[model samples]
Target: MYRVQTSLTLLLSLATAIAGSVVHHDDSFQPDHILRVTAQNYTEACTTRYSVLVNGTSPGPELRLTEGQVSWIRVYNDMKDDNTTIHWHGLTAFTAPFSDGTPAASQWPIPAGHFFDYEVKPGIGTAGTYFYHSHVGFQAVTAKGPLIVDSNDDPPFGYHEERTIMLSDFFNETDKKIIDGLTSSPFKWSGETSAILVNGQSRQRTNSTGSCQLASICIEPGLSYRLRFIGATALSFLSLSIESHDLSIIEADGHYTKPLNTSFLQIGSGQRYSVLLKAKSEAVLKRAGKRQFYIQITTLERPKTLTNYAVLHYSSGTPADLTTVPLSPPLPTAKTVQGWLDHKLECLHPDHAFPTLNEVTRRIIIDVHQNVSDHVIWLQNGYDWVQSFPQSPYLVDIYTGRLDTGGLYQRAISQGHGFDNITRTFPARIGEVLEIVWQNRGTFTNGGLDVHPFHAHGRHFYDIGGGDGEYNATSNEERLKSSRPIQRDTSMLYRYREKTTPLAPSGWRAWRVRVTEAGVWMFHCHVLQHMVMGMQTVFIFGDRNDVMAQSDPVDAGYLTYGGSAYGNTTHSPVVRQYFD
Candidate 1:
């Protein structure tokens, strides 16, 4: 036994070395690092709370890699009680589906005290601002960071400096308590955000006297900066604007687009935008002497307005405390924010080139709704996905065909199972262009429409169009024929409100993706709570033979515990049958 363990360890080490050595492009750089997940006590929102973190930081460390480079990231889970997995948000795992970091979909959660290695080569055309976060439970609300790929191809625009602005919402309660409340019988929603963070830090007012520190971004006059805006919040959708500055958006979810200038920007959870900010001219700064601007983030919902503030400091001048930053132009009212939303609704990502699809091979319409039985549960197409445990994960089961004859698989195809036991899987052949229309039907109780940011795991899709109302095929055909669309991995399904009546038509978003990769890819709402309640499904592309033949040995070695070349396990009868 001891000898076998030693041999496995050596094989893993050699595999890691080889993975770190592979290069695809001349400008590619191999970025290899290890992140340890541990429980840490940190203070936020004027309170100290116990939370799970990566490398001792809430936002973790920024992972920088050049385009066309292979990345090897080893994550060691040292949390005292919980298993963890990190999902690279907006990244298409491509050939490495097992490394996609979705528990029960790509691979099982890494048991506490164990580690997993994620290896992926970001080939050409994968450059942009992205992020990584915990995919299990409420951990992602605090455990997340930036994943940036520098482009080998020079960009059309020029910038003197760059900054990554990560935004998140903070709650005073622990993750466990929050999860318990959200999933409880009565179905209590997490109340308004206690605080908002800019790059994981913000001034939390303890009392009327105001006791806390603010995060400041220093800037110099006469310089252009590329600000990478990442919306990492768990629940909040933010409407943000820098005082006296107009933002020119150049990139969305890692894809460069034509510059679109806007006074304010709306960023949904799990989405990213890269905007170019030309600093105030030196002449203007010298005339004003000392000045500072407030970078404000406000919630887009109504009833009670919540806002968070960060400081944009000019290095040449000093300003008063954060509280005293003059409110020359008062924070935007909800009405003003609504106006901006209406104006920018038609062209959210206006600059992306449209795809030339001879025809959409498949069209699937999915409806998002909520049902209350034992608890309030979110549903996709009338099905709630609950991860089955103790059994092999979905990928292993599908790849091995163990579940092919099982009742679950049969029901999945026929759509004959109850909502609680339904496993939604849409099958597609290789190279087929799929058009998915995501329809959002608001909750039943309040009839209040919520904006859901939907994300796909294995590929970026071309966002053809979106509108508020029931999806009409004839009308959609006309719209798609006239407009060119942008490519993105995550997009917001906008909600519209009725002016006179309380009931509004549902909103629908359409995107087209070509199924080039052969694997099980997940598509779901990026809102953590909604996902936890069950708003997700999978797209199984191609046949099992195609996927298994292309599986990376190193990745399979990790999944099967370095046992054998084929990585068969006894728990999964299907895997055992195929490999043994």
Candidate 2:
């Protein structure tokens, strides 16, 4: 028996070593394409700056690949403390549990000075503005970048050229200092945002780059350009407009939307918009017998100290004539919009389902609260996030409130226990029309509803209405009642107030959502900082297509060949299953 056992152990050890070695040398592997991250300490302007434990400097680098391409990415962790992993935002995978990156959920953390290679087979048809960030505690502080997948073969939305713009806010302060301050008091205003950056450079003052200004983009009278803009602020609801040009929005959250022509549009954090700009100015007509227009991008929330605004510079060789077009009316009501809204309401009030609802079987409420303090500042939905704790499954028949005490729930193996203090699990049925109600009880004086750009995984929904505890009476009532717009996978909770206190409704602070897909999806605040304060949640849309398919082969993406636990679950029956 002893000899047999010893032989079996040796064979297993050899196989494990072979698997690890083979994973690195596969023909599809490209370590050169790996996004090397290095999170180290530095002295910036006389203050100690810890750039979160990253593989390289400045939130890593943008990765460019093609659809259906099999690529290998290796991440090296150089920090002395804390474990880390990277999440490929919105990308689909098959053996993804090994790469899910969430500590305790998908795979184990990559220890300090160690490297982990991610075998990514880009979703067969993923081509849009997607991003990747650290899944470690507040690691997003140092890990974030554009995952650009090119596909001229079949453009989802016809466009000749495309430009990707990522917006972020910067802090010279260290992560440890911020967290210590917040934990000590947890009751003072801590929103200390000072500067904004496009890509990684803080264009507070323009250097050699000419596009820092809002009017630097130039166009020859009749050319069309596609611009993909991502709003990545930690705490700002961005209202964008052109000083004198018109923009036709063609897509939101990477999905095509009915084109809408307008001079101004709004984008909140974590949201993306693809706009088509056609230049038409009289100066171009004189030079080439046409009109030329410039594309300009500016924000509604003028930062207390603003710089590096987006601009398009256009020069007309000859005198060009520019004509102004009137704004297009809001979109008319659609069957998709009405059906989704009704389903949402019914989902929220299941016992008393909305009579108008076509399909609704579940509802969930993700209430957000702000914690204001001097040193450590942020919001906490329940508590801080802890990796060891198990989370609850997002999909459940019923929840026992007794088990949900002080942030302990069945769905979330462990609720908010980390940097963001946000929970990560919600339950729902596939195609069951789920209604999501986001309620914000302004607990802090400086607390207000920061615009949350909500996105879903496999489906989209019609936005009902978001208000400051109540509906906005002064705004367009018809637009709100008839369905503001039938947005897919993307919608913003508008900002209605600018007051320092949390009382400002900051536009529709409350939003209603109808769930229409059956898969695990994430809903989070667009503001990167707010997300750090626990403004994210997860939901699972059970395989509704397979009515008898009750047992979801636990997503292997949440595990590794080593046979260790992943999926962020620290609870019995596994709670992290929904988010990981």
Candidate 3:
């Protein structure tokens, strides 16, 4: 037994070496580093309390690192309350297949007052905006925080200063309460959000005097500075603007884009964007050699639904006149608008440019449709995650085949057991152009309720045509011309905007895939709640027959296997706060 353990340890060491050189200067990350976090529980006092165990007064601290470096972080759950796991969102790496932190698929939860270590190499494939949060069910309220990476890649338009804004929504309810509301009650039917929070504070008074009670970060005018924005809302996309200045959009999801000079910027949950702002100064005051311009952050979205604000404050040396930058042209609406209709027309006419076969050699279509009853629930490819409701104490075994109500399990039951169908396995071939047709069919909008921010790890895709379920040629051409740079990991699939025929088939939203890299990747909605509802699927590149690809789901029976090839055990409906 001793010899076998020694051999395994040596093998893991070699693997670590081949992956990258890891450096740990902080003693907190040491193997012996252990810390306890506590979740504050409260009720409906306008400013409600949350049921999350956090490291400090706030959530967690900012983990700063340079490019081309690897980091190892160990989180010890000292809470006397629940199990947890931290998921490094937007970071691309490979460890234990299950430890990637998708509940039911990864390892089980981290028992209260336990320990887990994450081996992370930030900015490996790409550099820019990304974040880290909890992976347990419904605990994101306590575990989410910002994971910022600066490439030392400076901007062409220089700024005097820069700051990072880690924005998140806070809930006062406990995980158990939230889960109960989501699973057993009418909350799912109504499409209600818990509450909105900026940073960890509610929109209450900020200054010392009662008159100045508000969460306000004051700034001076006449300076060009950069603001890094990371959105961590469970729902709701952020529509942001400054009351007086123009915000120059420079980056999204941590990836750079051609600078977009605009007044209003829209950011979805789990998405990030950066902007440069040149604060305006009052001309008459400047003429008298006095600074006069300042700006206030404003929102277009309803304030009560989801709270959002900005960070980073600066002042310029010389007082000068101010001006608002012209609004950037709207993003190509082809994929977001006409993509479905174009594809339908192409399917009927068989055009050369719109070829039947994609440049991608492999393809998989995911149908995120609603299996609506009077109950008003949603499903991913016909499977409802209803079984995961109520946060049971004991770890439960979930048979994926038996998950869907009318799925392969029903066939097995009718055919006297062991009869499995409809769970087809598509083995991935190297260098194939992989395509996935994501269809939204059911009762709610897009045949499904709730807007989904579709995201895929490891690759970006081209937006194809889609309509309100009916394919049209004109719609296709319009969308095709509007294709923008491939989004790194996040995109939105909104329900039809028209009021008449509300549930019209919102056609299709297609993305092209180049499987240049080989690995097991996940595609899911960035909305934490939507993901918990089973809006997730995994794609395997390379041969599925490979030993690594053939393993069963992580958390098989829901306990630590002392770490598998997929790393540690994680909980289902991956939440973003337990890691805090």
Q: Which digits, one per residue and each the tens of the lDDT, describe model 2 over residues 375-493?
A: 33333345433343344322211121212222422333323221122334454433344445555445466564344565544334545556555343235244444433433445555
Per-structure clash totals for the candidates:
1, 87, 40
Candidate achieving higher lDDT, 1 or 3: 1
Q: Between the candidate structures 2 and 3, which one is better when assessed by lDDT?
A: 3
Q: What is the TM-score of each predicted model, taking all chains together?
A: 0.84, 0.64, 0.69
C-alpha RMSD in Å of predicted model 1 compared with the true structure: 8.9
| Model 3, global lDDT | 0.48
Candidate 3 residues 1-580, lDDT tens each? 0001123432343333222222322333343222245566533214546666456544466666555664546666666767677776766533333335544433455556455555455544355666667767666655777667767566545787666665555555556766666555455421444434445543322222222112333355555777777777666655555544577777667566666676655666776777887755546335655343222222222224433233222335643222221133122111223222222211111223222232544345555665444344555545544214313211121223222323432453344321223432122333455445665554554333345667765445544644455444445546566443334456656555422233345545566565433344557777766666556555444332221223333233324322221122252121111111
Q: Rank the candidates by lDDT, best first.
A: 1, 3, 2
| Model 3 worst lDDT window (10 residues) | 571-580
Q: Candidate 1: minimum summed lDDT over ten consecutive residues — where?
A: 571-580
What lDDT would each prediction earn against the true structure?
0.69, 0.47, 0.48
Clashes of 2: 87
